[model samples]
Target: MYALVDCNNFYASCERLFRPDLQGRPIVVLSNNDGCVVARSAEAKRLGIKMAVPLFQVQEQIDRENIAVFSSNYALYGDISARVMTVLEQQAPAIEVYSIDEAFLDLNGLETNFPLVEYGLQLKQRVYQYTGIHVSVGIAPTKTLAKLANHAAKQYPATRGVVDLSDPLRQRRLLGLLPVQEVWGVGRRLSRRLNQQGVSSALALADCDAAWIRSHYSVTLERTVRELNGQPCMALEECPPPRQQILCSRSFARRITEYRDMRSAIAQYCSRAAEKLRQQGGLARVVTVFIRTNPHSQLETFYSHSASRMLSIPSADSRLLSATAHALLQSIWKPGFRYMKAGIMLSDLYPSGSFQPTLFDAPESPAAMRLMQAVDNINRSGRGQVRFASEMLSSGWQMQRNRLSPAYTTRWDQLPVVRA
Candidate 1:
């Protein structure tokens, strides 16, 4: 058996975790630079504030409805996610972290007569008690069905955020009611094509001949068909594969016109990308930088360019990556255009110490590695605690987060106080 546990309105719930007074209020969390809605509470959904809609487009509605808006507080969200995962780790025999707000648990080896739904309810309650984040749990014989059950738990309040699809009859009934897109692997486009083929619901897809699906569509979709029939086609990935490339990019709060500001932004992005590379114990052979004017801005001339440089030897050192990225930025930087966004990409990644270095190639020094490790350690304790001199200390190109909440869990100064 497998179980999927997913947080409810994760970002908004994280915001409400500390703000009890804001419970039941319409809330929404914005993307980077307060650009668009990324997460919304149930009340906000009820108000018809669609996801990913520009904040400016809904500003009047928000003001009229007394909606609570927040900039993405990633530090707080990450900390809370860690706490929730900790609770799950203690409860489950083995688990796979599917995302920041979702995980899959292995429920095999339990007593056959064990109450799965009751166990799921207890697990949900434990996570809420420990992390103050409500979660929905779905248990089933297959991972795909588990995901479907989790969706059902979220959609129907009568389930009380717990759904078990162990029975074939119950799975069939729910699958009949759900659209084909609600199936685990079927997406919007695929669902549309399936709908045209008379497979409009999960039950219909499950009823399709697996051999015919594989011949007509893809082997992957065939697996989805089998999984929908309560056969396990996908196994839990306890350890996710390492990424081949790391990218750090963001749109600026305002347009940048100066060369120095662009340099600072690229350096900062490269530093972040290097940190991720080191975290994954990987080294990059190529560093690329890109800058662009707002494509949506009619007043400014559109300009976008990127340049990449191959390193003599693969390395994850922040100084080396930042220097390479800055050089790439210099090569691509245009003078007149007002740049709205910039980013750094590190590619051709290899596991650290795995690549062979020639005599002419200059490998990263032990001293440099130690310094970077120290810097990462400090930053991990609290982000931006230590940064490269090239990274701007304070700059106008920084993201606009006017409505950001305090880092309640990560920062000592921002920690909530009890008056009692």
Candidate 2:
């Protein structure tokens, strides 16, 4: 058996963790730059505020309903997620972290004779007790079914936030009720195609022959079909594979017209991407920088361009990456375009110390590696404490987080105070 544990309204829950006054109130967490609604509390969902709706579209409703609004506080949310994952790590024999707000726990030996539902309930209670965040638990014979069980647990209040679909009959019954889109791997486009083909429900898709599904759709979809039939096609990955490329990009709060601002943004992005590459013990051989104007703006001309430079040797040193990124930005940047977004991509990656150097190639310096390690250690202790000089301290292109909450758990000064 496998169990999927998912945090309920994760971003909103994190916001309410330190603010008890916000409990039972409608809350919505905005995306980067406070552009649109990314997460909504259950209360907010009940008010018919759709996901991804622009803030301006619901401004009147927000004011009239007195809804609590917040900009994304990733630091607090990441810290809380770590706490929740820590609790699961201690309890489960083996685990797969699916996302920031979800994980899959292996229960093969643990649930031999013990009641799965009871075990799930215990997990749910422990997570809430330790982290003060509510989670729904779904237990099943396969990961896909476990995901479906979790969906049912969240959609129905009577499940008490725990559902077990280990029984084949129960799995079929629930599958019949759920739309094909609700299946783990089936996305909107696939679901639409399935609906057109009369495979509108999970049960219908599962009933189709796996070979036919593979021939009609893909091998991946076939695996999903097999999983829905209680056959586990995918195994839990304790350690996910390393990324082949590291991309650091963001949409700006406003259009950037000056070359210096664009250079600052790209430099910061390169520093971030290089940090990630080093964290994974990898070095990048190619650096790419891209800048683009807003595609939706009617007044501004749409412009987008990107350029890549091959490094002399694969390196994870942020200084080298930032310098290359800046040169790439200079090569592609247009003077008059009001650039709205820029990013850095590090590709052609190889494991650190694994690349063979040719006679003509200069090897990466050990001193440079040590310096980067020191910088990473300091930044990890406290972000932005040891940024490079090229990265701007303050810039107009920075994301607008006017409604951001304090870092309740990660920062010493931002911790909540209890008043009697």
Q: What's the count of clashing pairs in each model shown?
A: 0, 0
Task: Supply the global lDDT for candidate 1.
Answer: 0.92
Which candidate has the top score in TM-score?
2
lDDT for 408 in candidate 2 is 89
What's the distance in Å from true for residue 237, model 1?
1.1
Find the 10 residues in a row with the least total lDDT in model 2.
382-391
Put down candidate 1 lDDT per residue, 12-104, tens digits, no spaces: 999999999998999999999999999999999999999999999999999999999999999899999999999998987889999999999
Q: Tell me each candidate's TM-score.
A: 0.97, 0.98
Candidate with the greatest lDDT versus the true structure:
2
Pairs clashing within candidate 1 = none
Clashing pairs in 2: none
Number of clashing residue pairs, candidate 2: 0
Per-residue lDDT tens digits for candidate 2, residues 1-420, read 899999999999999999999989999999999999999999999999999999999999999999999999999999999999999999888999999999999999777767888888999999999999999999998999999999999999999999999889999999999999999989999999999999999999999999999999999999999999999999998888889999999999988899988888888898889989999999999999999999998987899999999987999999888888888887998898888888989999999889999999989999999999999898878645887777874488899999999998978788899999
